[model samples]
Target: MQRVVEEISLKAWPAFETINHRGWLMRFANGYTKRANSVTVLDEIGLDIEEKITYCESQYRARKQNPIFCLLSFTNPEVLDERLATRGYQLIEPSLVMGITLSERSLNILPIINQETLNDWLVAYHKLKALAEQPSSTHHMILAGIQSEILFVSFKQNEEIVACGIGVLESGCLGIFDLVTSPMQRRRGYATAIIQGLLQWGIDKGAYFSYIQVVKANIPACNLYEKLGYEPIYEYWYRVGSNSGNEK
Candidate 1:
């Protein structure tokens, strides 16, 4: 069922798109989509890696102008470090593609946030992005179309907003994104709570399954998803490369 849902959703909108970065090709897509296309990075001196990195940065920056660059990732590509050497774009922490099954666990529906609580939710989101090295924006306008949808955030015992998550209902499934907890707030099962909340919310909306993406090397996250009743269906590689005047 989950596989079928993913296939239909992908076909409808093509969760990810590929871009050329001057001889290097990269995948740039909405992070909420959970699709990592591919990226390939190769080193060349005269072309200047810094220039290429700048161009790539500009591409996303331009995307932000349209309110679409809220979240994105540069995935696994050959010779990434080698190409970034000249650009000084330091590699950030790796991520894993993790998910959960809606059929295997009992979920609880948390209360919705009121206008007063919306500010608090935004703060929590900002903190999570800070920890994850993600870009920041209060693009509530972008979410205007989704006002009827529910956004869930789970707090710790001290109300420190430890774990934050969101779910988008499409067809018969829920796509989860922005699941993060503070480093100091780890090991309190907050992640699990949020997942349960999101799953329950999806089921309430008549969803058939839940899906999310995590870096392959994130052992803790992977284990957590497995414990929550998620199993692997397919794995895709991310490759980034600088553009070399190729149109395709």
Candidate 2:
């Protein structure tokens, strides 16, 4: 299940550039998001863990980025996480990979506005998330890199977009990302509406499973996802080197 979800996520939120160093997937996206700019252990075939770490660090340093290692318990070397910590890598953003099985009932939910234009979706996403210009530009590049079927959904109140989310469908699975709601519109069920809408659309398109990645510290979001029947299937966290200036 770890490998399956990780594979789905790699496609659901792709990086602008990916370099496979033996068994590690070194993803880069101009340091926009850690998920897109970290070393992810995808296989156990590679030997010489220290050598691979040195190589990945050099690669990230060449681009002026501090190397970040994203570790999944079952996929990474058992000692890698500890080794990173001893070398001054900070553990951050302990998150859960949650999923729910979709059924015919999800199809009955009403759909929301499906923004067809990538620019339009980007505009809405930036506004809803209040992202700055530089990161927003990098976000655009990352979203543009997605190769699977994607749904850019927006929820509006009185014709004003109050919430937005993205659903990427691949191999019968729907991966949800960047679910955001306007600050002034909190507790109004806008986010809930967006999730339901995305699930509806995904199920209509033949998706039988849906997953989301959320930080453990986000109590509200974790509770909401729990209410929606999403359960934690696995966990992953980023090990950040001391020099990671813009770590997320």
Best candidate, lDDT-wise? Answer: 2
Tens-digit per-residue lDDT, 1-248, candidate 2? 66888988987888888998887899989998899999998666356877888889889988998899998866655688877877778899999999999995655657465564678877887887776663377788888889999888888888998888898999999998989999889988888888888888888898889999999999999999999899999888999994553322
TM-score of each: 0.56, 0.92
List lDDT for all candidates, in order. 0.52, 0.84
lDDT for predicted candidate 1 compared with the true structure: 0.52
Candidate 2 Cα errors over 4 Å, as ranges: 44-46, 105-107, 114-116, 132-135, 242-248
- Give model 1 RMSD, 1 decimal: 8.7
- Evaluated against the true structure, the overall lDDT of model 2 is 0.84
State candidate 2's TM-score. Answer: 0.92
Question: How many backbone overlaps does candidate 1 show?
Answer: 28
**Best-matching candidate per TM-score:** 2
